[model samples]
Target: MSRPRDLYDDYTPSQQMTDAIKAWEDIVEQEKEVRRAAREAIAAELRDARVERDGVEHRVSQEAVARYVPWSEATVLGIAREYKVPGVRQAKKKAADAG
Candidate 1:
């Protein structure tokens, strides 16, 4: 095994290094495009998600959506707001009642 080299040393970028960086940049751009599409699809579904309560259909709560998506509730709300998802709102927490 080779010993670690000093990372702070001033060095010229080699052709291999430059090519690899360009390749990684292209890959990252493609990943961003795919992620954008996925977010839009997920947001659309989340916006339309519904549940039956008292024999009437209602939009699922953002908290529930967050749990189902396995993302933070705030993150889910952020995406909803970004995508203009309808019927989703930030929930207000109520303090416990004092006896």
Candidate 2:
């Protein structure tokens, strides 16, 4: 394999090299700032979209829960009765024993 060339082998004058390097560094710094700004803008848009989606999901869940409130309440009451709470009255003896 051919050996890799040394970077400074054909070196230009120090002053010329320093000026060129400074110009390139300035360009790179500006590009980095532009990229950072673009990333922030994208992140803000994503956060707004997520908030909108969450609002829609919350509304849907609330509607569904309202539609089934009576059934849900009945199921909960039945479970409480089976577990012998005083209000349900299905297992008075068990409730008294626990008390």
| Leading candidate by lDDT | 1
**lDDT at 79 for candidate 2?**
35
For candidate 1, report its TM-score: 0.62
lDDT of 1 at 42: 65
Q: Pairs clashing in candidate 2? A: none
Q: In model 2, where do residues sit more than 4 Å from their true spots?
A: 1-14, 49-99
Highest-scoring model, TM-score:
1
- Give the alpha-carbon lDDT of every model: 0.78, 0.48
Which segments of model 1 are wrong by more than 4 Å? Answer: 1-12, 88-99
Model 2 residue 20 CA deviation in Å: 1.3
Model 2 agreement with the true structure over 1-99: per-residue lDDT tens digits: 999978986766788889999999999999999866654443333233222352432112222322444345454344334444334113235655785
